[model samples]
Target: MKNYIFCLLAIVLFSCSPKEQVQTFMTYNLRYNNPNDGENRWEVRKENVADLILNYQPDVFGTQEGLNDQITWLDSVLTNYSYIGVGRDDGKQKGEYCAIFYKTAKYNVIKQSTFWLSKTPEEISVGWDAALERICTYFLLENKETKQRFYVFNAHFDHVGNIARLNSSKLIFSKITEHNPENYPCVLMGDLNLLPETDPILYLSMQMDDSKGLAGESVSGAEGTFNGFKHDKTVTDRIDYIFISKGDAKVKEYKVIDDQVEERYPSDHLPVLVEMEL
Candidate 1:
C-alpha cells in the first residue's frame, strides 16, 4: 500500500512538471502582390510558397510584404495555422502586412497587436525619413502542453531610408522592453533590409543573439537570403535575419532554405529557418 501511494504521487508530479519544448521559426518575404511581375507574379508562385511552408511546417513563421489578399489566400491554404496583423497603410486591410502565423494546436495567442514604426506608434504614421509605411506585428503566446509563454515579433524596415532603419531598430527594442518586461523568451524575425555589419543590425544584435552567429563555424546552407528571383549567388545580399533574446533559448540549427523546383523559386527572398529549444 505504501509503495503504490508513492508511485502515484511521483506520476502526478511528473505529469504536472514542465516539459522541454523545441520550436521552429521561419521568416520569409513574399515580395507583395504584383500583376506586372511577369512570371514571378503572386498567382504564379503562390503554390510554391505554400508548399515550402507545408514541407517545413515551422511552429511560428512571419512574412513581410504580404498584401491583404495574399495573406488571406495563404491563411486559406495553411489550414492548421492562424495569424495576426494589420495592414501598414491605415491600420486596416490596406497596403502590406508583416504578418505572423503560428500553429493552433501547439500554441494559443494570449495577446497580439501591431504598431507603426514611427514617432506616433499608436497611429498610422511613418517614422523619421522613411520612404513608406512600416509596421511590426507581435504575439504573446502560451504553449498548450507546458504552459510556457513567449513573445514573437515580426517586422520590415524601410528599404530606402538610412535614418529610418536605425530609428526603427531602436523603436523595436523599446517596444519589446515596454510590452514584455518579463522578457519572455522573445523571438524577432524579419527582412530587415540591412546587412549583418550594419548599424541597425548591430543595434539589434546587442539585444539578442543572431541564430546564424550562434551557429558560428557550424553554419550550413546558402550564405545569402535575398535571391531577387535571379538565384544568382554573385548578385545576392544577406538582409533577412532571425534573432532570439539573450539567454532565452538555445539555437539548434540555422538554415537559409534555398530549395527550388524545376528552376522556379518560391519567393524573391529565401526563407531563413531557426530551430530552438526553450
Candidate 2:
C-alpha cells in the first residue's frame, strides 16, 4: 500500500511540472485573397503553415499577409502561445494583417504595440498610392530569469508601391536604431518584398546583419517562396529573410523551408527561420 501511494504521487508530480522551452524563431508570409481565390484558396494551405512552424519549433513567429480568418485559425490551433498586432491594409478593419506569436512558457511579455507603414501612420489604414499598407509588430520579450529581454519587429512592405516600400524601410530603420536604448537586443523578420541587393535591403543592413544561408549554397531552400499553389512550380528569387541586429545578438543559422508535404504547400512564400543566441 505504501509503495502504491508513492508511485501514484510521483506520477502526479511529474505530470504537473513545467516543460522545457525552446530557443528559436520563424517567419512566413501566408498570402491573402482566400475569398476571391475560389478553388486555390488559403484554406487549402493553412494547416500546412501551422505544421511547418511546429516542426521548426520557434520560440516566436512573425507572419505577413494573414487575413482575419487565418489569424483566428492560427490563434485557435496555437494554444501554447499568444499573438497580437493588427494589419493596416485597406482600412481600419479590411485587408491583410501582420502578426507575431510568442511562446508563453518560454518568455514573459513586457510590452507589445503596432505601428503603421503609411503617411497617415497613426491609424491602421492603407497608404495612398501603395500596393498594400504595412504595419510592424513590436514585442519586448523577457525570459523567466527576468534579466534577459529583447525586441522583435515584423512587417510586410508594399509589393508594387516602390515609394511606399522605401518609405516603410526608412520608418523601420528609425524605430529600431534611432534611440539606441542601451544594449537592447533585437530580431527583425518579415517579407520585405525586396530582394538581396535592393536599396531597402541595403538600408536594412546598415542597422542589422541580414541572415544568409551557408557559404556554398546558392539559395536557402526551394527557389521562389511564392508558390501560386503546390502545383505551380517555378520557384525563384530570395526575397524573404530573417536578420538579427549587428550589435547585440548573433544569428546562428538561417534557412528557407521547402519541404514537400503531402497535404499542400505551407504558404505563398516559404517560411524563413533564424536561430539566434545572446
Candidate 3:
C-alpha cells in the first residue's frame, strides 16, 4: 500500500505540465516597526527579512508594510534586483512606502506606478487614516525572453478603516479591469487585512482571481496566515494574499510556509508563493 501511494504521488506530480517559463513570486509585509521604536525605524526587523529574501529568490516580489528605510535596506542586500523607481505610500507619496522588486536578470522593467487608498491618497503624503495611510504600487513587466506583459500591484489596506478598505478594493478593480478591459493581465498581492468572507476581499475577488487562497486549496474556506509572534503555531486568520490577473492566468502551485527558523516565517504573515501560466 505504501508503495502504491508513492507511485500514485509520483504519477500525479509528473502529470502536471512543466511550464519552465512559469514565474515564482512572493508577497510579504516586512513589518515596519511603528509601535515599539522611538527612532522611527523600519530596519529594526531587517535581519529577519534579509535572510528570507536570499532563500526565496522570487522572480517578482510585492511587499506591503514597508517604509523608505526598509526598502533601502532590502535594495542594499539584494543587488541583482531593481525596484519600481521610488514608490509612494498612498495616493500621495509620503511617510510610508510600498514597492515591487524584480530580478533584472529574470525579467525586464516595462512600466511602474503607485496609487493611494484614501479620499486623497497622493503618491507622497501623510494622510489621516483611522490608523494609518495606505498605498498600492503596481509594475507592468515583461519577460526578457517570453515578452509577456503582466502587471503586479502591491498594497496595504488601512488597518482600522473598514470603509476605506472596501472602497480601495473597488478602486483596484476599476483601475485594473474596468480601465483595461481589452485583456490586460494583472496580479494583485498584498496584506489586505480582511478575510475571504469579508466585504473588502470579496469585492476585490469579483474582478481579480485570488491566487493564494480562494481558488483551489480551499475554494470556500480560509487558509490561516497571520501567526502571532509568541505562539508561532497558532494561526487563526487569513490576511495576507496573492492574486493573479482576470484572464489566461491560473495559480498552478500555492503554499504558505510556516516554520520558525531564524525569525523568518514568510513575514509575520506567511509569505505566499504562486506559479502562474499564460
Note the Cα lDDT for every prediction shown.
0.91, 0.74, 0.70
lDDT of 1 by residue, 1-278 (tens): 99999999999997876643778899999999999898999999999999999999999999999999999999999999999999999888999999999999999999999999989988999899999999999999999988899999999999998999999999999999999977688999999999889999999999888988876665667888888889545335899999988988777889898898778678899999988887
Q: What's each prediction's TM-score? A: 0.92, 0.82, 0.80
Give candidate 3 regions above 4 Å deviation.
1-20, 34-45, 85-94, 121-129, 178-182, 213-222, 262-266
Q: After superposition, how far is residue 71 of candidate 2 from its true place, in Å?
A: 0.8
Model 1 compared with the native: what TM-score? Answer: 0.92
**Number of the top TM-score candidate:** 1
- lDDT, model 3, position 65: 66
Clashing pairs in 2: 224-235, 224-236
Error of 1 at 167 (Å): 0.5
lDDT of 3 by residue, 142-229 (tens): 7877677777788888788777888888877767764455566778888888888999888777766778643375332225777645
User: Which is the winner by TM-score between candidate 2 and candidate 3?
Assistant: 2
- After superposition, the stretches of candidate 1 with alpha carbons farther than 4 Å from their true spots are 1-20, 232-236
Writing each residue's lDDT as its tens digit, candidate 2 over 96-182 gives 777889888778888877788887676766665576557887888888754577888898877888778878888877877753376
Give the Cα error of residue 200 in candidate 2, in Å.
0.7
**lDDT at residue 54 of model 1 (Cα atoms):** 99
RMSD over all Cα atoms, model 2: 7.9
